[model samples]
Target: MRLISRLNPAEGVGDFWAYIRRPQPYRWPILGLSMLMTGTLLFWVLQERYYLPPERPQVTYITTFAPGRTDEEIIASNIANEARKDALAAEQAERDEIRREIYRTFGRAAGMDVEKIEREAAAERAREEAAEKARREALIGESIAEPAE
Candidate 1:
């Protein structure tokens, strides 16, 4: 009641309804500020960086060769390199076998024929297409004559 009395009715009969009907001085500036803040907030949120975990850690190696290497050392190093090559080839073969076994296991679990699936399915697809073509031709075939005019 004290607050209501303090409001000036003398200021152009500025009652509650009139005050509400009147244009707000700060409306557009407040709206613009609010929109700018929201836009900046959304921009910051959408453009934020996200780091993903790597599948494997990066590996780096630094190698140096001696200038005064002997013949015996060179021959031993060559033999070691040859042994490393054979080990690498064996590792690759074992990895391939393991991959095939994994695929076979999964295929069996899924009730799928892993080995014969690709080749036999291709053959079956070709047969099915030929059968469908023959069926369509038989329905609208040269062998079947048109009705008499």
Candidate 2:
């Protein structure tokens, strides 16, 4: 019963409540010091680091046409030149892709027979050229036979 009374809340609850209600004098200073230390550490870390400046953007300008050229002509020439360059680049890329595809497709078997392949390709090209010539000749004959408009 004595050990139970020492452990019970109803027996010592008044003293416990009184101790909790008492004010502690060091609480404000401890809280203030902790806040000051945190602020100082944050300031030191932010100020000691090296920060790089933002990079400037690159700007490109095309060359102006010579004097006496109209605005429309200059614009048209610029558009045409750009189009031609783009088309040439596209064609070169397509040719490179075709060459790569052909090499990949035939690289295994073409190790020793590359010359034979070339010969066959040449013969095929010759046959196509002959057929085109015949077609052109037939067209010329038809034109010659037609009456004058």
Candidate 3:
């Protein structure tokens, strides 16, 4: 406190502020201008909150082949499909992983819960089988109709 008082301005150092203390002719106009500016800023902020738009939704679709085809044929038709998916999933998982590693690479990259991923993959496979079954049924629709005994 003693050190701060030593740095204070002297009693007789009056200058600009002394002359401005009296009610000048322009004081009312200056005060009104300041109030107008403050009100305009508040109005703009309130208007902005009401006028903003909502977020848009994002959607994606992935196409897959029908099942019942030979393993070789299916693999050939979609050679890099599994690899591509694995690579992307692995990359996303790496971003989420806390540890840097070599041996756990596949697990780290595949970030999904093992059981959940397996279930989803199985469901996808079943859908493919169902699609193939429907295709076959459509092809054989009237050809194998029963004859009267």
Candidate 4:
């Protein structure tokens, strides 16, 4: 506060304060200009906030629904009825296929031959996994050592 008072003398009025007390010729014009600007800002704010905007929507969304319809409301109504029809039909078809397969006695059932083949596949997979692990570890070791060097 003292610093600000230093710019204008404590004893006498400053130039700006003096000019404000005894106005110049263009003071009324400046005041009018400020009032005009404030009115313009107020008008713009009222138009934007209080008044309704134009009905200009994006092209993709314009075709989706009517004016009053929202995407969420449409989806919420359709989710339990129309959307589940196709899904339920597909699920029933899958269950029927599984039921038919369980009744059939022609195909190879779960037995020793299947176990033997599975064991061989698992052994092969383990070997491939160990090789891949060794290769990845070697690459990682090389990467780490190169940075240090």
Residue 44, model 1: lDDT of: 88
Ranking by lDDT: 1, 2, 4, 3
Clashing pairs in 4: none
RMSD of each: 20.2, 17.7, 23.0, 18.8
Of 1 and 2, which scores higher on TM-score? 1
- Please list the residue runs of candidate 4 whose C-alpha ends up more than 4 Å from where it truly belongs after superposition: 1-112, 142-149
TM-score of each: 0.33, 0.30, 0.24, 0.23
Per-residue lDDT of model 4, residues 29-129, tens digit only: 98799999999999988885456788897676446446688888888878866768988999999998787556443234643354456578789999999
- lDDT of each prediction vs. the true structure? 0.83, 0.81, 0.72, 0.73
Look at candidate 3 and tell me the lDDT of residue 119. 74
- Superior candidate under TM-score, 1 versus 3: 1
Q: What lDDT does model 3 reach?
A: 0.72
Cand. 2 Cα-lDDT: 0.81
Candidate 2 residues 17-111, lDDT tens each? 67656798886687699889999999988886668998998988675667689989989998999999999999999998799568756865656
lDDT of 4 at 137: 71
Residue-pair clashes per candidate, as listed?
Answer: 0, 0, 1, 0
- How would you encode candidate 3's per-residue C-alpha lDDT over 71-145 as one tens digit per residue? 898877676888888899999898756353442466557774655665787899999999997898688764447
